[model samples]
Target: MSDTRTPLSRARGLGSAKEGVHHWWMQRVTAIALIPLVVWFAISLVMLSGADYAVARAWIGSPLVMVLLTLTIVVGLYHGQLGLQVVWEDYTDGALRVFMIVFTKFIAVLFGLGAVLAIMRIGFGG
Candidate 1:
């Protein structure tokens, strides 16, 4: 195949980064994974509403509940990070875009770890 890109375009290295498909698939997968987890969480909250602190803590202390809650936190953060990454990539440019993407990811991870730690501490009666 003949080279179709103009000399200027080639010189500028403007082309597909070859990551679009992977990013798209990950977004879709995370969205699907979040659906059931979020529904379960919403229902659990509704059921727990107006309950005393001990009751709520006991609920979270269940092994199954702890595992599911951890999954929810991790998956939700990852999904959120993926979304903010796309927004940054689309709306920003150059150094600002890079900074926003990295910053968003870092914040997501930090918050995710903190949340998981809190959940574990409560679930384990620490």
Candidate 2:
């Protein structure tokens, strides 16, 4: 077998882990998905700004609105998790990096579920 890597490359120990492309693609996909969802959400919020509680509740109670809201929450959480994971991976290492990533994921999931539940409660008139 022939060694193709240079001395610095071997010394630095930085090599492709074969997962970077997948991670990059996932980040991009989530970002693209968030664009329209966030735009819709922002516009909806603006339109609902002056509405009363009943009107707001009715808007959220709509099936389409509920579905879109759920999607927005879920995707936004996932996207945030991915970005935070990358930051942790880049800025920290060893146990702290692992812990940060795990903690970030936990918080994201927790908050995401909580938000969705709240949305569901309002949407279903619970």
For each of the candidates, the C-alpha root-mean-square deviation to the true structure, in angstroms, is 5.0, 5.5
> Taking the tens digit of each residue's C-alpha lDDT, what string does model 1 give over 6-64?
88767766456834467778889989999999999999989999889899888888999
| Candidate 2 RMSD to the real structure | 5.5
TM-score of each: 0.79, 0.76
Q: What ranges in model 1 sit over 4 Å off?
A: 1-20
For each candidate in the order shown, give its overall lDDT on alpha carbons. 0.89, 0.91
Which candidate wins on lDDT? Answer: 2
Predicted candidate 2 versus true structure: per-residue lDDT over 38-86, tens digit per residue: 9999999899999998898899889999999999999999999999998
Ten-residue region with minimum lDDT total, candidate 2:
12-21
Pairs clashing in candidate 2? Answer: none
Give model 1's clash tally. 0
lDDT of 2: 0.91
